[model samples]
Target: MEDEIITDGKYRYIEIGEGKPIIILHGLMGGLSNFQGVTHFFPTKGYQVLVPELPIYDMPMLKTTVKNFAKFLEEFIAHKGLKDVILLGNSLGGHIGLLHTKLFPEKIKALVITGSSGLYESAMGDGYPKRGDYEFIKKKAQDVFYDPKVATKEIVDEVFATVNDRMKLVKTLAIAKSAIRHNMAKDLPNMQTPTCIIWGKQDNVTPPNVAEEFHELLPDSELFWIDKCGHAPMMEHPEQFNQILDAWLVKRGF
Candidate 1:
């Protein structure tokens, strides 16, 4: 995935297949490779999949807000000359997609969010007192998934590195605060974009109830659940996640 990324001016992304675009938004600590299942599966199924590298840490401290990330997405969409595209996001990425849709509804065709943090604040970047402790960091990473094994050594190392970095750590905390400040509960009902909410039944990060609340708040939303899955349904249960999203897109004629 790293080798496949195309660097065009200020935007760096992965574009595959050729059809209706499905722009993927990676979460705060998530990388483009996290959506390997999506990038590979969707392209073969007649949809162009794109995973943009969000400037989560590159922005100035004051600009490190979810709203600015939404604006950046709009710029990326316009740069690519895309229209009526589907936006699929997870965690912080999901929050950005929601804000983007609310701000720029004309171009989005549909939205898919999993383990998103709009109503309920996530525990990301919390309890970092033991940032220097490898075992502690490893355990924290494992907590994101129902199956602790999903948090591989590489994943743990990546998270450890991010939290240990001074700049990235500060920006991460800033984004977390921005997520809380920009809660979408009051704005969900007014935004009528068709949404597909696929959640893990055992997600401990955002929890299961958040999905139900999203379904209740969003005017046009359908929720699906994957058993034994955690915050990252796509990573933990990619097959189920893809299947549910595929069926929803077909049913809604997207």
Candidate 2:
């Protein structure tokens, strides 16, 4: 079945399949297009997936703070009349998911974070790639994958399309700066929800060590490391990600 975009008020999202609901959150790039490759996999397994296009990219005034994103998620859940959600968040989306779970534990059943941000500050500097700097965007895309060659032309084009707008560039920088100041290390121990942490062994963005630190922090969490993968495992290695995710879900009795 094809993914369909459904609008609830001003919120736009892709909702697919039925049964237990799984909401997949996108990272700083801020759209569902990059995640389409993996989002469709859940429906066939009898799980519904919702990918919301968060409004952070245009709301520069909010600075894309974790707190605000968490609040947005709360409103999202309430507006959609959703309950017992499993948040599969990647990068910034993961950061938001972690925060949301902490703030609204009753609304979520389990959490899955992949190369998620918010645990630690990124060393990639505080600025977004300059508009029209194709090479810079290309390099950033390459870093997201362990094998740089997989950073295809289409991927490069997608990156270009996201950060090319001046407004988007500004919002990206603000979000990056906010992310740098984010540190959920102190709060992880307090998160009691069943959580799964997935990371790329060679992830240059959120390095493997950071994943280990998260494992140490979350008392009831399990960590999985994927070899030859970088930041975005669901995109870089979907089959392996799917296998691990399916097993984890069943083990958790989802």
Q: Indicate which candidate wins on TM-score.
A: 1
- Model 1 lDDT, residue 14, Cα: 92
TM-scores of all models? 0.97, 0.92
Residues 4-35 of candidate 2 have per-residue lDDT tens digits of 67877889999888988999998886357667
lDDT of 1 at 199: 95
User: Model 1, range 14-106, lDDT digits (tens) per residue?
Assistant: 999999999999888788888788788988889999899999998999999999999999999999999989999999999999999999999
Model 2 steric clash pairs: none
Model 1, which residues run further than 4 Å from truth? 1-3
